[model samples]
Target: MNTTPPRVLTIAGSDSGGGAGLQADLRTLFACGVHGMTAVTAVTVQNSLGVTGFVEMAPEVVAAQILAVATDIGVGAAKTGMLASAGIIEAVADACDQVGIGRTGTTPFVVDPVAASMHGDQLLTDLALEAVRGLLFPRATLVTPNLDEVRLLTGIDVVDRAGQREAARALHDLGPEWVLVKGGHMWADPECLDLLFDGSEFVELPGPRYDTKHTHGSGDTLASAICSRLARGEGVVEAVRFGKEFVVRSVRASYALGAGVGPVSPLWRLEG
Candidate 1:
């Protein structure tokens, strides 16, 4: 059997708290047994409490990082997280297009529309939302978005199961081959339910809703895990299933770090 690990790339911001952003992506990739690479789009001064400030990198710098990785180490799959600006989003989309990402390209790509934090701090601008939907969504093997992001991208406020279906179709219209509407913010039900749409059928992934607030990096972790599975050649549906299972385990084993919420440890399975 071939023993070489798959290589996956993450284009995102840096969270100083080590609980989210690139730090979380790298940790999740490592736990999923993939070699992780990165292209920092911004540096955020954030912690368990909240974000104070952030500075986005120049579009050229972000493009250079992606190009450098694509041309040299190469990537089996890639994921995009917190792109802070329209210019950065366009740049990343362009670079990924050149390097070939998603169904129309050589590599599979996961797009996590990370527009806000768990604590509701805005990480992406209002104007950049259009860029994300237009440039990145079409190139994504799967696009993961929470309720707020769903409304932001598709103009549909999803509250129930029917609303979720509507939101998924709206997002599909924007271009992603598949869409996973995250249910972490669904307060109506005690059980967590994620809806996955592939433009035809909907797959409902249900799990026990944990009553904890220490889910700082859950989104990043889930997206990166999906990317890692795809890097290892798993199909999109299988990748999403594995990602949800992995996140449930991680969230179950989460512990407090700071005064506020802590991150879900990607290596939780190894801890036991």
Candidate 2:
């Protein structure tokens, strides 16, 4: 019997801190029982405090990595994070279109829409943001953007559930199959809510709001988890639900690692 696990790919940056980026992505994928592959787009110099600096890989190099993985090992589902520039965004978008979406096989794509770090360091530029929408958004199976990102992408202030609906609609106009507006930053509330819109209906997924500062890689973990579930053939709603549970559990298990905020622990189950 072929016991090969489902494969999921992460096209994102590399975090030297080991708390986020490709590191977090791989950990989450493994925890979900999937094979994790990477197409590194940038190398970030960062720690718990924040990103000190970063160097983006060339567009050609980024494309090469994706092609190498897609043609050889194959990707069941893929997620992208921190494509820092327009060139990289276009390259990754075009590559995914041809090698993943355009291919006869199904390879679902998840867009994390990482605009900044938890510490408030900008990751995506204005040019890159436009490129992401114009080039990548149309090809995405799902786009998971936080409140700030939703505001950035749609120019709507999403302070409540009402705003989320408006933003989701505006975002859907940009052209993704589904939109998940993450409300994890709704700091004033005890209950955390994430809104999912599939161009028809809205699903409100609410989870326990954990008060923790170690949420450094929470976004990456959630997106990776969703991609992993999608690779296993779960529906968009199912994958989002699983992703939320995974992130909340991971956040609950968060612990301090460095001087600043720590990361959500992907190994929450094994450690405790």
Candidate 3:
């Protein structure tokens, strides 16, 4: 009897802080009972304080990493975090297309449009942002963007649930099969309500608003959880719901580690 776990690939940057990016992604994937793989796009001089500096990998190098795994080990599902430049985004899009890892391909792709850091540090440039919307959005099975990213991509400020719906529509227009407008940054809200739209209907995913500053890797954790569930054969909606529940638990289990903010813990999965 074969006892191999499902495989999920994360094409994202590396955070030396171990709070966000591929570090968080791999952690979440492991907690979700899947084999985690990566295609590193950049390396950041980041810590709990913030990202002081970073360096992006060559476009071909990024593409080569994807090809190396997708063709041989095989990816059941994939998610992207921070493609730092336009060239990197284009390269990733081409490689994903070639390796059949998008909406039109065999593997489901989750595009997490990481625009900035939690401390308000910009991660992607305007050019790279446009590339994410034009190049990756169309190929994504699901695009998970926070409120800030929603504004950057759609020019619509998501102040309320109605605004989230509007942003979801605008994102869906970009051609992704589904859109999840994360409302974690909306501090004014009593509950953290994430809106999921699939062209026609809207699903409101509401969770307890945890009052914690240790949410450094929450976005990466959520997206990676969704990707992991997809790799485990769950449908898009179900996977998203599972992701939402998983992230809420992680946020609730969050703890401080460094001087700045710390990360949400996926170690809660061990409780069972």
Best by TM-score: 3
lDDT of 1 by residue, 1-272 (tens): 98779999999999999998999999999988899999999999988888888899999999999999999999999998889999999999889888887667889999999987675555677789888988889888899999888877777888888898899899998898999998888789787899999999999999878888888889999999999889988999999999999999889877788888888888785575
Task: Work out the TM-score per prediction.
Answer: 0.96, 0.96, 0.98
Q: Cα deviation in Å at residue 208, candidate 1?
A: 1.1
Full candidate order by TM-score, most accurate first: 3, 1, 2
Q: Order the candidates by lDDT, highest first — what do you get?
A: 3, 1, 2
| CA lDDT for candidate 1 | 0.89
Stretches of candidate 2 off by over 4 Å are 102-105
Model 3 regions more than 4 Å off: none
lDDT against the true structure, each candidate: 0.89, 0.87, 0.93
Scanning candidate 1 in windows of ten residues, the lowest lDDT window is 116-125
Report the lDDT tens digits of candidate 2 across residue range 153-210.
8778777778878888999999999999888887765789989998999999999987
Stretches of candidate 1 off by over 4 Å are none
In the predicted model 3, the residue pairs found to clash are: none
Supply candidate 3's per-residue lDDT for 200: 98
